[model samples]
Target chain A: MSVNISKPSFQPYTGEKARISRAFDYLILVLALFLFIGSFHLHFALTVGDWDFWVDWKDRQWWPLVTPLMGITFPAAVQAVLWEKFRLPFGATLCVTALLIGTWVARIFAYHLWNYFPINMVLPATMLPGALVLDVILMLSNSLTVTAIFGGAAFALLFYPSNWPIFGMFHVPVEYGNGQLTVADLFGFEYIRTGMPEYLRIIERGTLRTYGQYATPLSAFCSALLCSLMYTLWWYIGKWFATVRYLNKI
Target chain B: MATTSEQLPVSLESDSKIPWYLQDLPLYLKGFGILTVIYIGLRLYQGAFAVASGLDSSEPAFEQYWMQLFYVELAVIAVFVTSVWGYLWFSRDRNLDQLSPKDEIRRYFTLTMWISIYTFAVYWAGSYFAEQDNSWHQVAIRDTPFTANHIIEFYFNFPLYIILGGSAWLYARTRLPLYAKGISLPLTLAVVGPFMILVSVGFNEWGHTFWFREEFFAAPIHWGFVIGVWFALGVGGILLQAVSRLIELLDMLEEAP
Candidate 1:
C-alpha cells in the first residue's frame, strides 16, 4: 500500500489571505484618517495657531514664514514612514488634506455657527500645492537629502503665493479713519475678540519693515532654510517613533 | 500540508461552513455608530447651552447647565474606564501560548478596530473641540478653567480617548501571544503618550491662571499638548510590527480551497 502526502509550500497571498490583507489596509486607512486629522491639527493649531486662525493674522512676515515651518513637520514625519517602509508617497498630501478637513470643520462649527465669527475671518490657509510638491519630490528623488533641501524649500516658498488669491484682496490698502489699514485689519477691528487687543497682534514687526515689499520674500527664504532643517529633523523623528522593536519592559 | 496546531488545544468547529476571518466587523461598525451619536449629542448640548449659561461659571445657571454635565461626565468616565478595562483584563486569554494562528490573526484585526476607535475619539478631542476651545475663548472670557468648552474638551473628551487607547493597549497585551511575551514599545508610546495630554491639562489650566483672558492657541503654554500629540506618530511603528507579524501568520495558513 502506498500513502500519498501533500507538501506545504509558501505562496503569495491570494483569495482569503489577499482579502484579509485588503481588509487590514482599509482598517488602516480609517485609522490613518483620524490619526492624521487629530494629531496634525492639534500640532498645527498650537504651534502656528493664531496665524492660521484669523485672516488678519495672515500677515506677509509671520504667516508665510511660520505656517510652512510648522506645517512641514507632520508631513515629513509621516513621509518618513509611508515612503521608506511602504513605498507610498502621499504622506505630505495626506497630512495637509487632513489638516484642511479638520480646520474647515472647526471653522464652520466652532467659529461660524458657535461664535458668529465671519467665515472669511477664520478662513484657513491651504498648504495643498506645497504638500503635493513635497510628496512628488520625495517620490521622484527617493533621497532624504534631496527631498529636504528642494522639497522643503518648495513647501515654504509656495505658501504665500498659493494663498495669495484667498487673502490678497484683504491686504489691499484702504484709507479708514484717515489711517492706512487693510480690509483684514478692518475685519479684525469690527469683530472684537476678547483679550486680543490690537497691540497683541504679531504682524509685520521688526527691522524687516525697512525692506518694505521685500519682507515677504525675505521671510519665505528664511523659512525655507529653517524648513529644510526642520524636515530633516522630523524625518528622523518619524523613523525613531516607527521603531518595531519590542521591549522586555516599559 | 500546513503546519498543524501543536501549542493550542482549542478546536475549530467541525462544520461544513467556513468561518469568516473578520468576525468582529459588525461590532466595530456598531461601535462607530454609537460613538458618533454620543459625540454629536454632546456637540448639540454645547450649542444649546453654551452661549446662554456657559459664560458665567459662578452663576446658578452655570452650575445647573455646565457643572451638572461635568459631574455626569465624571460619573460616566469612571464607570466606563472601570467596566471596559476590567472586562478586557478579566477576559484575557490564559493560554495565549497555545493561541492558533487563525485566532491570533483575528485578534490582530480586533486590535486594529480598538485602535481605530481610539483614533476616532482622538479626532473629536484633538481636532474639532480643541480648535473650538479657541473660538469659545475668543467669544467668552475664561474666568475659570471649567469653561463651556473645557467642560467637554479637556475633562470628557480627553478621558474618553485615554480610556479607549488604554482599552486597545490592554486588548493587545492580554490576547496576542507576542504582545503578552514582550511589551510592544510603539503600542505603549501611542497609548501612554496621549494619556499625558490629560496630565498637561493641569499644567495648562495653571498657566492660564496668570493670563486667563488671552487665548493664544500657539503660545509656549500650549506646547505641552503638542509634545503629547506627537507620540500618536508611534502608530507607524505599531503598523510595522503588526504587518510583519501578520505576514508570518498568513504564510503558515493553507490556501483557501
Candidate 2:
C-alpha cells in the first residue's frame, strides 16, 4: 500500500507588498460585488422584456450588432487586467464562461424550471463558444492589440453562424392569415404585443424581392465590424486596468 | 516494553515557548462555524417551504412567491457575515509565515472550501432567483422596464454576482500571500468583467424601455451588453493563468523530497 501525502510550501512577503496587494484586492472586491448584484436584476429585466420590448426596431440587422457590443465591455476590461498584468490567456474564456453559465442557468430556471416561458419560444442568447474561440486565438497570439483586431472581428462574424443552428429554424418563411412572413415575424406575432403593428417586419414578401429573404449575412458583417472597433478600444481599457501603479502612489 | 519515550520523534514532543492551543486555536474555532450552521439551516427551511408549497394544487398562491424567497436569502447572507468575521478572528495567529507544513496545507484546503461555498451561493443568487417568476412570459402586454421580471433579473441577480465576484477577488488578494505580490490579471478580469456586465444590466433594462420591444439580434441599445459580454474572454485568459500558477505551486511543494 502506498500513501500519497503532499507538503505545502509557504512564501514570506514584505508588509509593504502585502498592503498594496490588499488595496488591489479591495478594488477587485468592489468591482466583483457590483457585478454580482447587477446581474441578478439585469436578468430579470431581460426576461420580462423591459429593455428588448420594441418590436419595430427588433431586426436581424441591429439586434446582433448591439448585443455583442454591449457585452464586449467586460471582456475588454478584464483582458486589460489579465493580459497586461498577469499575461493570462484565459481572461475572455473565464468571463465568457461565467456569463454563459449565469445567463443560461438563469434562463433555464426562469423558463423551464420556473415555468417562466416555453423554451422553444424564448432562449438565452448564445455567445460562449465565440468567447472561447476568441480566448484561444488571444492565447495563441499573446498580443492584445492583434487579438482585438482579429478576435473582435471573428467574434462578430461568428455570432450568426453560432446562433444560426438554433435561430435558423425560426428563420423559415411562414404565411399567417395570408401574410407571408418569416418565422422571425411570427416570433413577434406570438409574443411581444406592444403598440408596434404586425406589418413592420423587415422580411421579403412575395411581392417584394429587392433584398433576399435572408438578412443574416449583412447583419453578421456589421456585427463583426462593430466588434472589431469595440475590441480596439477595450484593449486599451484592459491595459488601463492592468496598470499597477496608482496616481496617489506616484 | 522498552523505553516508550524512544518511540516519539525528536521534533514531535520538542516544545517551544508558545502553547499549542494558542498556535492552532484560530484555525478551527473561527466564527465561520456558527455562520455556516445558520446559513445551511435557513436554506433548508426555504427549500422545504418551496417543496411543501409546490405540492399543493388548490390555491392560486400569490404571483410573487419567488420574490419572497429573497428575504430568506438575505438571512443566509447575514449568517455569511458572521462566518467570515469568525474565520478571520480564529485564523489570525495562523498567518502564512507562522504555519507548519501540515497546517499550511490544512489552511489551503479550508480556503478552497470557503471559496467553493461562496461561488455556489453567488450562482444561486445571481442566476436562480432572478428568473423565478417568469412574469414576463405570463403577461400579455409589454410594460415598463421595471416590470417584475426586469426588476428581479437586472436589479437583483446582476448585483448579487458582482458582489460575490468582488469578494472572491478581495479574499485572494488580502488573505493569500501568493496573490499579494503581483496582481493576478485573470482574477482581476474574473472580478471586474462580471461587474461591468452587472452595470450594463441597467443600460439593458433602460434600452428595452425606449426600443427593442421584440427580439432583434442586433439593436443599438443592446450593444452595451454585447460589449460587456465580450470582455469575458479577457477574464478567461487571466483565470487560466492564475489556476496554472496555483497548480505549479502545488506541484513544486509535492516534488520536494
Candidate 3:
C-alpha cells in the first residue's frame, strides 16, 4: 500500500545511467566545441575580419583600437563563466583555440573558393598569447579588478609581440612606387583583389616623418587603455551571464 | 520504477543524508531528439541553397535569386516571430502552482536544447558563414546586401538563430514555472542578446555603406555585433539555474519510484 520508495546506500546510476551520463558529456562537449568554433568566427568576422584580410587596414591608429576592443569581450566573458562556475581560468585558451580553428576553417575554403588566395595572404595572425595572458592574470591575481587593470593591459600590450613573429618579416622595408613600403603593403598590392581598389585602402596615408618612431608604442598604450575599460565592462557582463538565481517556483 | 523489493536503493528525495541528483534519463533523451532534428534541418537548408545558387556572387541568377530570397526570408522571419509570441500569449498557464515537476524538468531540458540549437545556428550562420562572408566579399564586388555572401550569412543564416532563440523563449514563457508569471531575466537576456544582432545589421549596413566598406571584422562600428555574442554568455547563467532545478527533480524521481 505504501507508494514512497525507501532508502538504502548504493549507487543507482551504476550501469545504464552512467552510460547515459557519459553520452551526455560527449554530447555537451561536441556542442561546446561547435559553439567555440562558431563564436570565434562570428566575433572575429564582425570585429576584425577586415583588418585581418587586408594588410592595408592594419594601421597603427585603428588596428589597436579595433583588435583589442573586439577581442577582449570573448576572453573576459569566457573567464567570467569558467572562473565562477568551475574555478577554471582556461577561457583565454578556449578563445584562442576557437579563433585559430575558425581561421583554419575560413582559410581552407578561401583557398579553394576565392581563386586560391595564397595561404600566406589569407591566414590570420595568431592571438593565442593574448588569451593566455588574460587567463594567467586571472589565475595569479584571483581578482577581477586586478585582472581588468593589469591583465587587460597585458592582453592588449602582448598582441603585437606575439603576432610579430608571423608578420614581422612582412613589416620589413621594401622599395615601391616613390618611397619605402613594408613588405605587408607590397603583399596587399600584389594580391590583385578586383573589388578592393587601391584608393579604397584605409592605411596610414601620412609619412613616417609625421608618425615618428614612437607610433607603435603610443598605439599600444592607447589600446591598453581601451582594452582595460573593455575588459572591466565585459568582466561584469560575464558575471551577469554567470547568474544562477531563479524566481519563485510558482 | 524502484520498489522496496529492489533493495531500497537510497531514495534521493526521502533519504536524510542522500544527495538530490540523478541525471534524468527521459528528459535528456527528449532534449537530444529536438536538437538533432534542428541540426539536420539546418544542414538541409544550407545544402539546398548551396545547390540552388552555386554560391557564385556575380552570376546573374545569383543576384536575381538572392534579392528575391532576401524578401522571402524577411517575410518568413516576421511570420515566425509573431506566431510564436502570439502562441505563448494564448497558451499561458493559469494554474502555476499545480504544474508538475516532471513537466517542468522536461521544459527546462527543451529550453536547453533550443539554446543549443541557437548556438548551433550561431556556428553555421554567424561564425562559419560570417567568416566565409569576409572571404568572398573580398572576392566579389558588393553592389547590394543581396550578394551571395549576405544571402547565406545575413538573410538566411542570422535569422536562423533568431528563430531558435525565439522558440526557446516561447517554450520557457509558456511552460516553465520560472518563466510563467513574467519573463525570466536570464531568459530575456538569452533571447534579446541574439535578436539585437539582427537589429545591429542595420548599423552594420550603415557603417559598411558610409565609412568602412571592407571586410574588416574588428572595425569599431562592428563592435555592436560582439555585444550580441557577449549576451550569449547568458547560456551559462541559464544552465546553472536549469541544472540546479534538474538536480532537485532527480531527488524527487529518486524518491518517487
Candidate 4:
C-alpha cells in the first residue's frame, strides 16, 4: 500500500546528462515521425487486407487469445519502468486504458463513423475493465507471486463474466438450416463463414457431455491461469531491465 | 612509515597484476569461444533436423519466405546490439568521476541519446510495425505458424521490446545514481513491463495456433496483453512526472536568490 519511499538526495544534471537527454529526444522524434508515416500506410493496408494479413484466418477460439497476449506488451514494459522508479500503482491500468482507448477510438472512427461495419457486429473488445481489475488486485496485493497466482487467475476467471452482458445475449439457442445452435453459433456462422464453419462453435445443446453450456467459464479459467504464469516471468524481466548499474561514459 | 614516490607505481603495478585467466584478453576470448560454439551447435541442429526432414517442405512457399525474413530480422537485431554495446564500452572514460557538472550533464545527455535510439528501435518494432502488421493479418488469410502477423508481432515485435525493456533497466542502473541505490517504483515498472510483454506473447501465439481466427475484442486471451500495454503507458507517464520534478528542482537551484 505504502510503496513510495523517501526521495533520494538530488544532484544537478551534468552537461553530459543534458546532452544525452537531447540526443534521446531527437531520436524519439525521428522514430515518431517514421511511425506516423508508416501507420497511415498500415491503416490503408488493414482496410483492404493485404498479402500478409493472415490474422483474419483465425476463428473466435484463437484470435481473442493471440490479440490480448500481443496487446499486453506495452503495458507490462511500462509498468516495469513506472512501478520500479516512481512507485506508481496504476501502471498496468493506465497502459491498458490508453491502448483500449486508442483501439476503441480507432474502431469507432473506422467502423462506426466511416461505415466500415455496424457497431453490433464490429464492436471493440471489452477486456480493459478486466485488465484494470487485475492491475488493481496486483497493487493491493503488492506481491508479484500473488498477483500472478491469484490476480492472474482472477483475470482469466473474470474474462467471460465481464463481457457476458454483451456476448451472453448472443448465447441464445437458434434453430437454423440444419440444426439448433446457440446464438453464438449463428453469429459465428454468419460472420466468420469462410474459416469458422458451424461445427467450430463450442456451445451446449444437450447432446454433448462435460456441461457443454459452461464452455465460457472453462475457457476463461484456462486463459487466466496462463496469464498468471506469464506475469511471474515478465515481472522479473521488468526488474532486470530497470537496472542502471553498468554505465560507462564515452 | 616513510614512502618512496618512485616505488609507488612499481609496487602498485606488481600488486595489481591480474591473474592470467582473469586478464581482459582471456575473458574476451573465452566469451567469444563460447558464443561461437553455441551458434554452430544451433545451426547444425537446424540443418540436421529441420532442413533434413521434409518439415520445411510442408510449409507453403510464402511462409518459407517469411521465415527467411525472420532470419534477416534476427541478423539486423544482432548487428544493432553489437554496435550499441561496442560503442558504449569503447567510449567509456575512466576518469568519469572527476567530470565537472556541465560535463556530467553532457555525458548524461549522450547516454540519453543512446537510450532514445534504443527506445525508437523498440517503438518501431513493438508499436508501429506490430500494429500495422496486425491490421494486415486481421484482413489476410492465416496459414502456418510463421504467418506474416506472427512474424512481426510475436517474433520481431515482442522480442525487440523485451530487449529494449532490459536495456532501459540497464541504462537506469548504470547512469542514474538515484536508480543505482535501491528499488524505485517507476524503475520497477519500466523493467517489469517488458517482461510481462514477453510472457504475454506466448499466450498470444498459442491462441493463434490453437483457437479462432477472427480478432475478438472481448476474448479472455487478449486480457493479459491489454493489461500489459496499459502498464507500459502508466510507466511512461510516471517517468515524465519524475523528470519534471527533477527539472523543477534544477530550476530552483539555478534561481536561488
Measured over all alpha carbons after superposition, the RMSD of each candidate to the real structure, in angstroms, is: 6.7, 10.7, 8.7, 15.0
Worst 10 residues of 2 chain B by lDDT: B54-63
What's the best-to-worst order under lDDT?
1, 3, 2, 4
Better of 2 and 3 by lDDT: 3
lDDT of 3 by residue, B1-257 (tens): 54784556545345643112223435545655764575455444544554366356566766566666667777877887788668766887777788777566555655665666667777776665666666666656665666666765677667767877777787777777766665566766766877788788888888777643455555577778777876666776776666666666555543332
The prediction achieving the highest lDDT against the true structure is: 1
What lDDT does model 2 reach? 0.51
Model 4, A207-235: lDDT tens digits are 32355554444555566667777666666
lDDT of 3 by residue, A1-250 (tens): 8798888785555443344334445545555666677776677777677677655566666666567777888788878878867687798788778778777766766433444677766657677888888898899889988998898898888877777777776777888888998877887887766556676566655663367766667778888888889988887877877676555532
lDDT of 2 by residue, B1-257 (tens): 55467666554546444332134324323433543464355344434444434322232341235335555456654675567555654554536565354343333333443443344444444444433433232332334453334434455445544554555555555555555555666556545755676576677666656654543323355556544433333333443443344444444343321
Query: By DockQ, who's the top model here?
Result: 1
Candidate 1 structure quality by residue, lDDT tens digits, A146-232 = 999999999999999999999898889999999999999999999989958677799988889688889999999999999999999
Ten consecutive residues with minimal summed lDDT in candidate 3 chain A?
A: A15-24
Identify the runs in model 2 with alpha carbons over 4 angstroms from their true place. A1-58, A71-101, A128-141, A191-216, A242-250, B1-76, B86-91, B94-116, B131-257
Better of 1 and 4 by DockQ: 1
lDDT of 2 by residue, A19-61 (tens): 3234334434433432433342243234323222232223466
Pairs that clash in candidate 1:
A8-B1
Error of 4 at B231 (Å): 15
Cα TM-score per model: 0.94, 0.56, 0.75, 0.46
Per-residue lDDT tens digits for candidate 1, residues B71-140, read 9999999999999999999999999888889999999999999999999999999999999999999989
DockQ ranking of the models: 1, 3, 2, 4
Interface RMSD of each: 0.9, 9.6, 4.2, 10.7
